[model samples]
Target: MHGPASSGWLLVALCAVTGAYCLARMRSGAEGQRSAAGGEALMGFGMAAMAVPAAVFTPPSWAWPVYAAVFGAAGVHALWAARAGAHHLHHLVGAAAMVYMSLVMAGSPAHAHGRGGSGVPLLTGALLLYFAGYVLLTGVRLVPVAAVAGGGGPAGWGDRPELARACRLSMGIAMVAMLLTL
Candidate 1:
């Protein structure tokens, strides 16, 4: 594993901070919509942490299931909370992509599948592109809102809505990095 010396610690810290922030946001009388957006941001951070290091470290086979579980749970949660067409589509594709990656890792010839190939890499790249496109679209939709508000708007540039947009960007970047590694 060629991961950073503090990769594990960094992951833990990111998760904790995001988790705490979400909890605080929820407890602050935030609406379900806002909380859901915050949750997406937290999930994005988690995904970024996992995907980035996993690409670099290429952890052992057993780690695949762990990745699947983490990503699967997040995807499911996002899907459950998704109301808009774009959000639903994003979660659906993300869930499928994570599942595909998990299966590929589990069935690697080294894990005894024998029918080895680079299909997983190609599929992952496609998924990453899809995700990146989705994020770009969503981010574009958010820009006018962020710009018009300029800090004093109903949902400020740094508000939950913007946070969700930021998360999409981070997830898109992480997916791209993961695809490149593949």
Candidate 2:
């Protein structure tokens, strides 16, 4: 995100597209999938906004706190939602990471340039490791398993498990890149 404007724009495009897909995923037939999709949608959009190139748009100083507050509330909701499924635990961690990044950005004088605190905080390092592993694990999961005995027709866009996993993987990779910028 701190790199060339082109890279930042790429991040924006990747995240925005992922967010759009997640929004569509909210129409999934499964109620639980819908809930998870909603949370993922929020995270994708938020990351897109945060990764925007500074040359394009620099948020006001107050925006960071607003980001923190919104993500904090999201984290709380994710924690509550985690009771229904373990997947929501990932959402909780993602939300907390966003809140942490927001706070760091808020305290940074050069945040508009995507520079945060003087050095990577321990928490940031931990989060980076988490996301890196998540990306790897999700990547592994995306690989095709054995063919189904009864090959059902392709799933609807909203109900495709592979797509959902891919969405999470993209976000995880994005989170790692963003953290590195910090």
Model number with the top lDDT: 2
Q: Clashing pairs in model 2? A: none
lDDT (Cα, tens digit) per residue for candidate 2, span 1-182: 35567888988999999999999989877676698998899999999999998767878989999999999999999999889899989999999999998887787665354444466678988999999999999999899733222236656678777788889999999999889877
Q: Give the TM-score of candidate 1.
A: 0.59
10 residues in a row with least lDDT, candidate 1: 109-118
The runs of at least 3 residues in candidate 1 whose Cα sits more than 4 Å from the true structure, single-residue gaps closed, are 1-28, 38-42, 52-60, 77-86, 107-122, 147-160
User: How big is the RMSD of model 1?
Assistant: 5.5
Clashes of 1: 0
lDDT of 1 by residue, 60-132 (tens): 7787687678777767776776664456556656666665666665555332322345354566667867877
TM-score of each: 0.59, 0.90
